[model samples]
Target chain A: MSREAADGRAGTTVGPGPGTGTGQGTGTRGRTAVAPARARHLRTRLGLIVLGSLLVAVVGTVVLVDQLFGRAQRASLVDLLERDLQRVQALVAAGTLGADFVEQGAGGVRLQFVSNAGVVLLAPDATDPIPLAPTPVRSVTGERAELVGSAAWLLPSGLEIGTIRMALDVTEADADRATLRLSLLFAGGLLALVAGALAWVLVSGALRPLADLARQAVAVDPARPRLARYRGPEDEVAELARALNVALEAIAERQQAERDALAEVAHELAAPLTVVAGELRQLASAHPDDPRVRAAREAADELLHTSQDLLTLARGELDRAPDLSVVDLAAVARGVVDAYPGVTFATDGADGRVFAQPDRLRQVARNLVRNAVQAAGAERVRVAVEGGAEVRLRVEDDGPGMTPEALARVFDRYVSGRAGGVGVGLTVARRIVASFDGRIEARSEPGRGTVFEVTLPGWSSQVEGESAEA
Target chain B: MLVVEDDARLRGLVREALEATGHRVTAVGTGGDALLRAVDGGIDLVLLDLNLPDVDGIEVARRLHADGEVPIVMLTARGDVASRVEGLYAGAADYVTKPFELQELLARVHVRLRERGAGEGAIERAGLRLQTDVRTLWAGDAQVTLPEREAELLRLLLTHPGRVFSREDLEARLYGDDLPDSNTVEVFVYQLRRRIRALGVADPIRTVRGKGYTVL
Candidate 1:
């Protein structure tokens, strides 16, 4: 939409211009935008949870069983001590109470007796005046630790004679309990390891679909935005995929609607703009010396550009695939250059046939040539189309170039170098080119003219049914 | 060639493009008409659009391919991957999505016409006659059985004698997505040379460096 506004649709008055605008990431591989790192963390969190629960369970069972076994062993030891004291009492009642019972340490129980006269007698293995203490206390520890019991020795006449004390060694039982606790702890640790490994495998299996879904989601082209229905069981993962697919459908529908509206606007505006521009060109040429006529034409041209850019911005978030075709690059460039008499066009190679969508190709050519003409004096603007293994379209402008800083960000949207420049024109061109399997770049130096080079594979690059493009 | 489409405007465009390329095109606006002309004969390839008024394009494709006499190329508005695969399975030799470029469509039609006999006879070119039914080429008193790939390549270069095909173009047509080593094109050319030489005929294939391969 420059120079009499004639290039908007050129000769076509009511064309729809299929690839009007959608300067978004138009290529097929738009990442799913489902934060990959966050989805990966889910696997780790699930695995840790499973491992933690098994550990808690294994350790609890071991400690509880150890406590119960220890208590039972101590209770049996105390009962054995009491039984030995009863035997001593029977001897005393038979009137055969001799030192032999105490000296023999009968029944393998240590015995001690006091005649109620301060006389202390001890078993052979017992120390003198065995310290009075409760039996089977948990803190008890010695080479000969015992469960000790004591009772009063009475005669048949019902008179208390002496006190008898009996003790049984608990060293063997304590050793057995120690061994049991050691084994229980070892088994508990082993069980926990095994269970943890099992949990890891189970979690990985259950969440396999999540990883698959993540990959599939990333591969999904946001333009079409469809995900395959999960064929597995209808579990949480399936539900999540369904939810994402639903959101994708909504996004696709909204995009389709916006594109439809903008396309309608483009179609509606293109016809009138073409007719108006066509008439203004005639009027300006007829009255070449009339400043008023020239001014009116420029204003109309600027208005067309503004409206077109506005329509493009409105459809900025949507991406539509273009209609594929074998285009003549030289022909398209020649048409754009013809609009400006000052710009020179040149061709190289025999044929300039390249596979692309024609409407988009025209739009990009117009943007590049227009930008070049505006930068340099129209006389210094040169456009060339080279045909080969790859088709090349180069537009060069010998204007006061840009700073290295400006050159680096030239393609960035909103980077304007001059007044009345819609900075996004170049960015839009790049997206359109990329959507058709082409590349575009700009090279410039401080004092040198800027060269915009676009490389698209020649149509001859494809032979027959061998093209892998979808 | 037969152009079958429900949309009148699109049908007109396809017919005009094919005719401009000098193919005898019979343009129709429904599946029923496409079937009648196809069975009646003289049609080499059918350009069938999937959305038709009378019947499903796939069903029409099956009936057309039932006798295995004619090959079909589908023009579908469904650009999704599954539909393309489904169309191929239904016996279409190839497909071009809707909103397609006219030039690309012409190129595809050109290739399909060469691969299958565009008319009902042996193709005669470069002092060699290729019998598609027997998959063999007769050169003077000698005959050599052409492998499938060689036959496809030979037919393409033979049909478009003046057109130049770059190595990249040859590779794409021969291998689709399965690109082999870098020397694949050279190897295939060498093999074609031997086959022609063994038949006691001068090689017709010539290489245009930095451009492509062409047959004179």
Candidate 2:
């Protein structure tokens, strides 16, 4: 069931999630990731920067071209108007120029001779004089606007004759500039769009190697140590791959050392225990009637039991977070209490459901029941499960309860106040409960007996199917 | 009995205990020596520790299994389920976690050796249990002490209950390369018949006509 839930969480899609460009394995394996997600923000940020730069380049080019076109148009119009005016001024001073010169145009330069007082001297129907200006104005001969340049008609002398004005039709130049700007705008937009799309594609592919690294990391078994495979270029992703492999190795070596240390402790513990057990049995056989030898044998057995519990505590396998599951605490308690003869089990208010490691929970239940029956000399004990926001387990024993001083150190390691009690059981139980993020407490009176209660954070039974989806 | 363990203390204790039980024990402290001894071919049962210094204990068990029909009992302190399962999977007949009572290990060894039914000093089958050291036979609740020749003849028949041992073949094993006379095997077989009747187990040994005898 846990494997199914993990598979469900780390769905078919691996690698970084789309659009997010995060190397968090999509919704994949992120929930159980050992190391932090790599390449999470770089891809999206780089793509955005590339696309933004392309867009800015496109817009800047359009505005610059528009300004240059405007400058070129003015220069060309001024050159055309001035050259035609020179012709008209020379002809008029030579006393051979006529208004019919406008009909003989050069490059659509319509020559109009206007008086220095700013009137159209050749227009017989004209009544209003135009303002004196060397700029484009109203056109003639099938056009609306023209480049009109006006000057005073002067001969060989520097005397100003009637002001001569020349006009050039600019309708075609304006139309051509419009066409160029329109195409530039269209092509620039297309280039920006393609560049942005290409950047997004390239960056999304950049994190593929990271996804492969994540997959390899997921498959690593701590029982066996190995390095992750990497054959990519020496870039940022390669750096990340190297870091990840080093991290895996460091963790593997630490765990291996811990296991070796634990095994060493077991061997060290087993040697003396083995000697005691062997010697105790040898003595018991020689003096079958001696009660001291029998007591020594019992002590040897308790020593073995304590050694086992010590090893369990030292290994700390149950302390790791990934082992937790949705456990039925009531069910675990029932399985434990069924073995002890005088214990009565009941579900008082609710079926206790908690999210914890099932193996550790079973150990906790066993320790409590053993402590009550054996340590307190309780012939009959009542085990109950009550549930609210927290699922609480209560074990009540009708034995000679402890005094306040004894109760103060009950959970301490090797602090047994009663005979036939191996003092490590309560300590192991307390550590196991604490690992589940729970609380354990006891209440007792000298004659009234004792009540030991454990409270674990409850998992709502209604959300059973939700975890399967996750 | 063959005891193979790496730890000096454990190896010593196991060797001393098995020898104290009236069994000849050959003990070694390494897998290399164990495989060599298994090849020597007098071992009945092997108490192999899984945590060896040179070769993996599982690999040793596999090699020993390939060597012959000797049963291997895993004796180690690694109590995790995976190790237990792996040990059993590697052709081990039984596994006893360490910090164990020496008596329990002895009891388990006794059972394995009995099932193999080739241990020289102790043999039990068909309601007849022979303690070779004492040369005594017990059938149901009754006991009968046997003479040397009768004990040797009874042990051979009880080792293989259904198979018939001829008179000549019995003489060869009982006298051990000494040429005993022809009626020498018959005199012991005749003495073994009276002891079977005294033990009160019916069909203890059958005398096939023209053949020798067998325990049924």
Candidate 3:
């Protein structure tokens, strides 16, 4: 049966039901869901940084432009008012200055004349005379007329005419300056908006290759051990990919070396073991009735068993998935029970077929049954199978159970509770079950019996249907 | 027989064990040497070790298989299923893991040789002798001429004495793809036992409850 069918059957069997909730629900646990990746994560970060810098630059330029324009406009307006005063003085020296002349000569410029003797010499049409405290020529020569709200100047007639004052309105220039400020503010805001968007687009475009590289890295399968070469240009992103590829290559090589070492060790161990076992058997045959020889043979068998268990435990550390197939769990349990003849094992259930590697599952069954037999001492060990969407195989033994502390670490490697126990059997069993996406749990109390329940995905009609569809 | 094993002590033990069983043995330490010895011919069986110091044992087995129908049995320290499958697919007739029972190994060797038609011409066990050449059974002073199928069945049982053979196993062996009725094996066993009893010999064929039969 297909794995999916087995999983579906298991899911249905473990579904909620009365009396099924023992406070430890397998349904709510052990399912790992991978969250989806946010596609624009890198782009958002890069865009934010680019937009922030563009805004600062746009605002700074606008403020600097406004200040420079205001200063230059003020200085030029003052210079124009000073030039108007000179034209009015020239007209008076020609003896052609009058009310009519003053009004026509000032063309859109507000002009006024006042005498140093407090007498008004000329004024614009229907306009009052300008109020001025005429400064001495000595003080006036060093200081240029300043434009304070409006431009003003003081002048002296040739040794006989009283000093005349000239003034001009700067309202039109001020209005022009205000219009320039408003336009700059509006243009600067608009430019900032466009520039911020442009920066976001440009930054996202530039980071696309990096994002692609990240995706490739995520897609790499460490188990397959292939180089993760970046196909982009030789930039920083490519450099990062190259470095990661080198690390991966190193890891693969190290793993290969470790596998070779393990194989070598296994062979080295097996060769001597074979020789010892063969010689012992031969000796036992020569003197079949000798207790010492029999004991020696048993010791050799124990050594072989321990060695094999150690090898299995080491293999479990490698964490490779087992080759799965449809297996009969009842048959496996029966075989294991049969191996231990004196143990009373009662198996009652339907043919519990599951998707598992038969040999590995057999190992798990053997380990569990052996432990149960050992724990029960001279008592009976009962093995039962409950067939449903999932097959639950239970091994119970009525003997001195473990303490709370010991029970907690029963599956831990090298933590033996009994004398001569290898302590790796349960660890290996747990690893095997987990490889098939199954679970093994234990319950025990001091002076009470211990129970080990192994739950595996069972093969059923629904699984068959799914497999057929596939 | 040719034995290819790198360990000198193991090679010596295997040679001694097989020679003690009355079979001549040619022992080699390397795959190259094994190949050379095998190519010399007159070898009925090969006991090959997978972890040879020189060329791989699998390659040697393949080359030997290419040469002839000589059966090859792998004896190695590698007990994993993958290696066992690889060895079998590479033309090995049987696989025996390291630290195995000497008796089991010998039994496998005997079976392989028998399958190759190089078995003992006559097997004698428990005061009964069945001669393959003459197709006759001798019980002390009495003798009987048996049918060909009965003689073949007795030979198979006597060779692997005390080993149980289920009815299905016997059926597969005797009939191959052309299976008769399910009780055909039972009738044959019944007739063989009655005929042997009439010859003044105690019946050696034992019926295992729920299983099939065995001769101890």
Best by lDDT: 2
Please identify which of the two predictions, 1 or 2, would achieve the higher lDDT against the true structure. Answer: 2
Q: Which clashing pairs does model 1 show? A: A324-B101, A325-B101, A466-B176, B166-B212
Give lDDT tens digits, candidate 3, residues A78-193: 56655656666666665666678666744445455555465665664325444352331111212323232212223334444454555455555557777877787678767766
Cα-based lDDT at residue B66, candidate 3: 76
- The residue-level lDDT of candidate 2 at A64 comes to 95
For candidate 2, give the docking quality class from DockQ: incorrect
TM-score rank order: 1, 3, 2
Candidate 1 lDDT over B1-216, as tens digits, reads 888887666676667657767888899988888888887788888899887878999888878877555778887644344555456556676676444445556777777776565433577777887776676888998999988788777776776554555565666556644667898777777787678778987677665434455665
| Residue-by-residue lDDT tens digits, candidate 3, B114-185 | 756733577888789888888899999899988877887898778765455567657655664466897999
Q: Order of all candidates by DockQ, from best down to worst?
A: 3, 2, 1
- Runs in model 3 deviating more than 4 A are A1-58, A92-259, A274-299, A312-326, A338-348, A355-357, A369-384, A394-427, A430-455, A459-470, B1-47, B53-55, B67-75, B78-89, B92-216
Give candidate 1 regions above 4 Å deviation: A1-34, A95-108, A114-119, A125-129, A133-144, A153-162, A250-339, A342-367, A371-437, A442-452, A456-470, B1-216
Error of 3 at A133 (Å): 9.8
Worst 10 residues of 1 chain A by lDDT: A7-16
Model 1, global lDDT: 0.67
| Backbone Cα, N, C clashes tallied per candidate | 4, 1, 0
lDDT of 3 at A69: 81
**Candidate scoring better on DockQ of 1 and 2:** 2
